[model samples]
Target: MRRLTAHERALWARVAASVKPLPGREVPKLPAVPTPAPAPAPVQPPAKAALAPGLPRRPTAPTTKPKPPHPLGASLDGSWDRQIARGRLAPDRIIDLHGHTVATAHGVLASAIVAGDGARVILVITGKGRPDRPARIRDELMHWLERPDLRPHVASLRNAHPRHGGSGAFYIILRRPK
Candidate 1:
């Protein structure tokens, strides 16, 4: 395990000190943070050879995933949107993608839609991701819905009411299976 810095240790101690233990349980001991290893000696870089005038350098990896592509499927009317936003529309089914990996969520979502049968409204919780981090589930949801497997069942995707998790969740209106 990586060692905690002096500042982190001190802060952890303060927070631990302030918390009350359960009625019969004693305060847990603090984990021992390992000290950082010594830095390696700096190595000099090899001299760079001049490149021919025209070729471009390789592109760097992207730091963040791109936002969802254009909307697809039937766009629900405004009344439907407002019904969801106001919390009046109850979902016939609900699926939570929080804490799941992309592949796992994809499988689960596919299975959910296939099994929904006659269910009309479905609530899917993708979890509002951290401001500092990318929202993998939310970002991938559009792509998932666009897939041929799940696309047929999804009539539309609408943002859930604030009470239902606001931007963290969606209302999946399904097309009635013939």
Candidate 2:
């Protein structure tokens, strides 16, 4: 080996000073690391509340029984007559009249008279005839009465007075005939 110059020796000494050597027993070794596991999914609870009060708990079942039909003529009574005098009738009576057939022209004329004369409580016999075409005429008459022109004549209406046709007829009470 060649002998170093004073400048080269000083440079070598500076480089050697920065470096360190570990003793055999003082050196450290890396420890083994463990991997982490995934978390489980959440669970949901079952339904327990009632849908509505007084209603059946099961959706497939009904809560109440159906009502029986009323006896024939049972719905007709004196109060109905008073209602007729007022030119007003119940929806049930109007529905019943749907069965009768007074001539369209005659019905129109009668409606006109009822309106013009202020006739209170006129009996309209809508016969329970023609099962194939029930209540056709009565329905027509009721429709006609509802027209703006005829409305002035009618005050109120009700099912036929008990003495009247009951379900088969109607009692139309006109506004005091004008």
Candidate 3:
């Protein structure tokens, strides 16, 4: 092979000088310096900091696992009146989403269901659409209730009673709060 040019040799020498030597070299190893032991962390007392001079600090609220939304259109397989009279079911809350737009209704429904407030049954009044003028909310309510965000709050949905607007509304069974 031809010898490297002067410029090429000089470049190689600079590169070699900057590079660290690989392991297994013949260089003598120096005695390892002993590292000083880490100082123990300062002890801190477990105490709540006072918010005011006289008042004690308020305790933090306990963490709780949120209840999952219930699915939509789940069958009850029983009579509504009998269930209600027997204390098995009671629709304590009602939300009328009749005149509201789809977006507004959806937001309201989601918020209502999630808030729960110890209500066992909630009546969602979605007015039935006429044959010529279809009620978009009525058709889409169940589909919206089935969504991941709202499904956890609703256990099941059924047609409301005649006194409760019949086909124009639905009964949303909210899951019992843990």
Candidate 4:
């Protein structure tokens, strides 16, 4: 190769002088950049109603009236007398209104009333008089019959026939509602 001319050599020397010299010691490490924290999530309020169209309004409260007392109590007292005098009621449909528990008796009576308005004859089996005790099934039946709620609905009530249950059971006749 031909030797560089003096002008070309002078240009190369200037370029070499512009470049930085490598450090004698190892290059210093760059400082670490800190990572930014994530932004917090947005909070939302509870919905009182739906945002969609045609949605129904939410209910705020209940809407109903309390029931009134039953009207059957007064009628029960004279039901048998009226039936006997006018032949308005029959005894053949008597049902045995018997149960060991008070709840059962009440349920049976409620169901019987609902079923036919007490037109059907029911023989309630209250059980024989409790020995050595005055509180018997028969007595409880008497108490239930005496309730004001049940009186008006009862057409007639009497002791059961001997073959049916004697004093242990009662024949309850329900009246048809007018």
lDDT of 3 at 166: 78
TM-score per candidate, chains pooled: 0.57, 0.40, 0.53, 0.41
Candidate 4 — which residues are off by over 4 angstroms? 1-99, 132-135
TM-score: model 3 vs. ground truth: 0.53
Per-residue lDDT for 1-178 in model 2, tens only?
9976555666666666566646664333323223334557766677777678788766566678886742222344577555565545443223233423456545544544444433444566676556686666655656666667666666554556455565666655554432
Q: Which digits, one per residue and each the tens of the lDDT, describe model 1 over residues 50-146? A: 7788978778899998977346534677788678757999988889987899999989888888896778888999998888977899999989998
Candidate achieving the largest TM-score: 1
Clash count for candidate 1 is: 0
What TM-score would candidate 4 get against the native?
A: 0.41
lDDT of 3: 0.76
Candidate 1: clashing pairs of residues: none
In the range 1-178, model 4's lDDT, one tens digit per residue, is: 9976555666766666576668775544333333445668877876755558877677778677776744333345565645544544445454454443667767676666556533556666666755675435556665676677776667666656666666676667677667
lDDT per residue for candidate 3 within 64-96, as digits (tens), equals 988664445434545764664454554689999
Q: What are the runs in model 3 whose C-alpha is more than 4 Å off?
A: 1-81, 84-90
Please state the error at residue 85 of candidate 3 in Å.
Answer: 11
